[model samples]
Target: MPPRTSLPRRAAKSPALRKIAVVLALVLAYQLWLVVQAQGKVGPGVGAQRDARGRFAVDVELGFAPERFHILRLQKHGRIAGTDGHVVHLRGVAPAGVDALAREYWIRHIEVPRRGS
Candidate 1:
């Protein structure tokens, strides 16, 4: 009769542990992708600028009508000094840059004025 041989407990669990590690790595990669996507959405705009007054000059797009009310909420940061069609021009103290306004609703894009302009 042949003698029976049992696998070591750690060796038996190796495959399961490897599977868990792979899943965790995949999840981490997916989370990183999501962060990149969000950051791209709020990337600094071309119209962003800093004037002699120390205020940031920005062009904000308040998507479609009715939802335009969101512009009012932005007044808390600073007033909408002007508008050309649907795009609202803003001059404010944006210490964090244009991306700081990304959290506001209906704000599709914030175009920052170019430097030295």
Candidate 2:
């Protein structure tokens, strides 16, 4: 009778396969780091100022012009109060909407609007 060999055991013994696996793991780790960095773009207390309607105001500083269009698309209910250079003042943004904005790599920063000008 012939003995059956396991495919996983064979893969574990191959140096090329081990190298490929290590590279894939490193790539995945880098991707996760990027996600964390992107989410960190949101400033402290930015999401803490929800109004009675559960919407907040934020100053979204973008990396470029086209990103403004993407932000407008992501925030359908939010209105652009003003824009100074690449910074856009968005109001009526829900918590979920803010999270979505944070996930965008093109968005450089998200912060609570200041009291005055």
Candidate 3:
């Protein structure tokens, strides 16, 4: 009779290794989502439509209390049309205005109607 040999176990079958793999997967997923957002693949809002004058009425949400600098930055891009609680309405948004405002960390999300919708 020939001698028998055992094969090495797979790393995925280990409990600790499995947990590390799951965490790594989650990190990769989040990075991918950020890339999609940066490329502007994700739509902003449902009714991000332009008005008759070709102006966008955007709603800006600030998750945390905004500082003076954030307010100034937003005002530089567009006029503060109105406000409801933490949400602010912006009018006369420029072509690159949305992108500029979104760069601010204080700004949580910008809602505007998608073009040609």
Candidate 4:
């Protein structure tokens, strides 16, 4: 039998290229939106301070509406316990803009600190 001639092969393009690009663009837009939301924004929040009794106490309040704050107590304390016998004392009133700011802050900060020092 005679030798077989070699056939030309078509150059390959990644089939998933378009899908990957779309995903990247969407992620970028979401991140930009979050930045715009958090920039120079002072949302309603309370800062906690540990008292001599080792109880978490929130002092000082910053927000737009006081009555809408629904804060019966300016400072509230809570005790958190772990299954492994770990206990954490936490105190704070739920902030007004916490729901909206939480997402923006989390995305921008990437991780939350145990406490702001």
Q: Return the top candidate by TM-score.
A: 2
Best by lDDT: 2
> Which pairs clash in model 1?
47-111, 47-112, 47-113, 48-111, 48-112, 48-113, 49-113
RMSD in Å for all candidates: 7.8, 4.0, 8.6, 13.3
TM-score of each: 0.49, 0.65, 0.51, 0.31
Q: What value does the lDDT take at residue 10 in candidate 1?
A: 62
The TM-score-based order of candidates, best leading, equals 2, 3, 1, 4
Worst 10 residues of 2 by lDDT: 65-74
lDDT of each: 0.61, 0.80, 0.66, 0.36
lDDT (C-alpha) at residue 63 in model 4 = 32
Task: Mark the regions of model 4 whose C-alpha exceeds 4 Å error after superposition.
Answer: 1-15, 44-100, 104-117
**lDDT of candidate 1 over 5-97, digit per residue (tens):** 566656546888879889999999976765454454444544345567666667667666424555666666666776766676677746554
Candidate 3 wrong stretches, greater than 4 Å: 1-48, 113-117
Minimal lDDT window, size 10, model 1? 39-48
Over 1-117, each residue of candidate 2 has an lDDT whose tens digit, in order, gives 888779999899999999999999999998787779776798999868788998888988887754646656745748878777777888989887887777767778988888862
Could you give candidate 4's per-residue lDDT for residues 1-117 as a string of tens digits? Answer: 987554322112444665777899999999887767655443223333335653332222223232312233221223222111121122432443332433333222211114541
Per the 3 Å backbone cut-off, how many clashing residue pairs does candidate 1 have?
Answer: 7
